[model samples]
Target: MNAIQIKNVTKRYKNVAALHDVSFSFESGKIYGFLGRNGAGKSTLINIIANRIFADSGEILIDDLPAKENIKVHEKIFCMSEADLYDAGLKVKDLFKWINRFYDSFDLDKAFEIAGKFNLDTNKKFKALSKGYQSIFKLTVALSLMVPYVIFDEPVLGLDANHRELFYDLLLKDFQHNERTIIIATHLIEEVANIIEEVVLIDQGKVLLQDHVSTLMEMGYSIYGPAKEVDAYCADKNIIGYDELGNLKIAYVLGEKTPLPKNSNLSASAMNLQKLFVKLTEKGGI
Candidate 1:
């Protein structure tokens, strides 16, 4: 299969397990929202995939080929990490030149073009740019590369609302032009809710769920009404979390939503991506 398959990958720091038997695939020609809470092993798994760190057990495969320390895999994947991995002393343009020299698939013209769109001063040393601009610079390089699988770890970090929107717009436009696997590991779930076709939610160093955005949207909903009615309606349902206000109650549930009892006072409302994420991660369940 043309995908990045993570097979029973495990990582630990001394006694703490960063990832435990993590197995999933980032299939080709799709955009994935890799959602996870802080310290949920998102970065650890990403680092393993990028070969920046080694997994304690198991392995990662990119398009059926071994991913770790493989030069061929280097051309197949690009990871835009939260940490700055570039030479701070080098000017942005110079760094672009260096990346161009390294990756045969990198488009130098597109890099400059994106830099222009972001108003990134290519002449400034990487260390001289502001935090947000530094993120822009890194994404600029990632966007310029036409690798089969690209991972963006917190791509919008430090970016203001306007810049973030611009980045999403540009990303969608880029994806529309060229289809590939784009894995976005970010906590800003609602921001990429619409952009992502699928969601791979991780919690407490383990995958909580992996489903299509539409399926999750359909399966996750809230039942609201009098506490008694809500409780009655939610009985035997996959209730993930809940909220209450005096006599009223709201049950956040996962699974096929059924119609309310005939003319019942209870109501079913669709749960948004952010709400679903919060509810599931809060309860770490169903």
Candidate 2:
């Protein structure tokens, strides 16, 4: 299959299991929101796929080729992670040149073009760039890659609002022109809600859910009304969490929403992606 398939992948650090029997696939030619809260094993999974770390059990396959330390699949995938893997003294343009030579799929001209769009100073050393500009440089490199599968772990970290929006716009434009599998591992769910076609949510080192964004949105909703009335309406529903404001309450729920009782005070509203993610991953009982 032309996809990144992970089968029964398990990873442990002494007593802690970063991932446990996790199985899922990121299909070809789609933008996926790889979402999870902190310590949800997102980074662990990405590292494994990028061949930075090995899984204790199972395997990672990119289009049926093993990804673990395999050079053949290296050109097929690119992971732009939070870690600084570049030399600090290298100028932005020099680093781009280096990466261009390292990866057959990298486009040097497009990398420079993207840097221009972000107003990134290609002449400046990486260490001299501000935190936000550093992120811009990284984004530039990732956007220019012509690889089939690209994994972006916090791709917009330290970016300002304007630059972030520009990145999103450029990303969409790029995807529209040349379709590929884009796995965006990010915390800003709302920012990516419209960008991602599918979502794979992980929690507590396990796969919580993986579905089309539209379907997940359709399945999640909130019921709002007086505390007692809302509670009553949610009694038979799949309530995930709740919120209260004085006498009023809001119940975040999964499953199809039914019409409220005739003339009842209860009201239903669609749950946004971020809210749904928060409720689903919150640690305590709700």
Candidate 3:
């Protein structure tokens, strides 16, 4: 296992800066949630890491080695995304064979086992499988790799409820058994919140915050009670967001939770990841 560092990485699309000097490190043997809203440069950063696209400035290093079209670096990391990479003329089984040829540690038997579990037919051509099945096949391929890092971009893109749950279970099992670095970039914050150890929240084209999930969760708490009391309690504190209905109120406060006044009706509870994400991402709302 090795660490991947994105040092002052910057990318542009004509005038729009996709990634604006983004810098972060993904440690070994942990799962990281690369989160952001639509057009938030999450995909740009992922693509740069995979060497699918180049960053106009800065560097990406894997274990201190430059990852600029470096074969060794590429071998250590595998990205399974929505980009259709498989040959449409080849069957799923054939594609697996081709992938096995490229990756020496690719477990063919395990891939087939996962395929059977996902109810994906191996004999079907790439173009013949449904969207969900295609996602299942790619996810199976990702699970079968014996690399140090595995990245999933929209991993459960078209998966149903049961399959999504099963995939999460299997992914947790795989991570526990092999202990590799897994980075999942997805919009489903609530689903992967518990699975990831660290959080990287990006907005617009820059990183908003990056820290341990527990630490971020501790940074804020939700206070609820009567509307006036809640509003008064949050006035001096760092208020991230709030919700009000008639006389009821809930205010999410960042920084530190202040002591309530004597005989106050306000109560405080830990804020959830989804709520935090919503509060932080809202434009000019928080």
Q: Pick the candidate with the highest lDDT.
A: 2
lDDT of 2 at 19: 99
lDDT of 2 by residue, 1-286 (tens): 7999999999999999999999999999999999998999999999999999999999999999888889989779888988889998999999999998888878999999999988999999999999889888887888999999999999888898998899999999999999999999999998999999999999989999999998888968888899999988888988877889999999988888788989889888877778888877887623
Best by TM-score: 2
Worst 10 residues of 1 by lDDT: 277-286
Model 1 stretches with alpha carbons more than 4 Å out: 221-270, 283-286
Candidate 1 residues 109-150, lDDT tens each? Answer: 999999998899999999999999999998999999999899
RMSD of each: 3.8, 3.3, 3.3
Candidate 2: C-alpha lDDT = 0.91
280, model 2: CA deviation in Å? 0.8
**lDDT tens string, model 3, 1-286?**
3699999998999999999998989999989999989999998999999999999999999989999999988999999988998898899999999999999989999999999999899999989999999899999999999999999999998899899999999999999899999999988887887899998888888999999999988878889999988877877887767788889998888877778888999788876677788878999735
User: TM per model?
Assistant: 0.85, 0.86, 0.85
- The models' CA-based lDDT, in order, is 0.90, 0.91, 0.90
Model 2 ranges with Cα > 4 A deviation: 222-269, 284-286
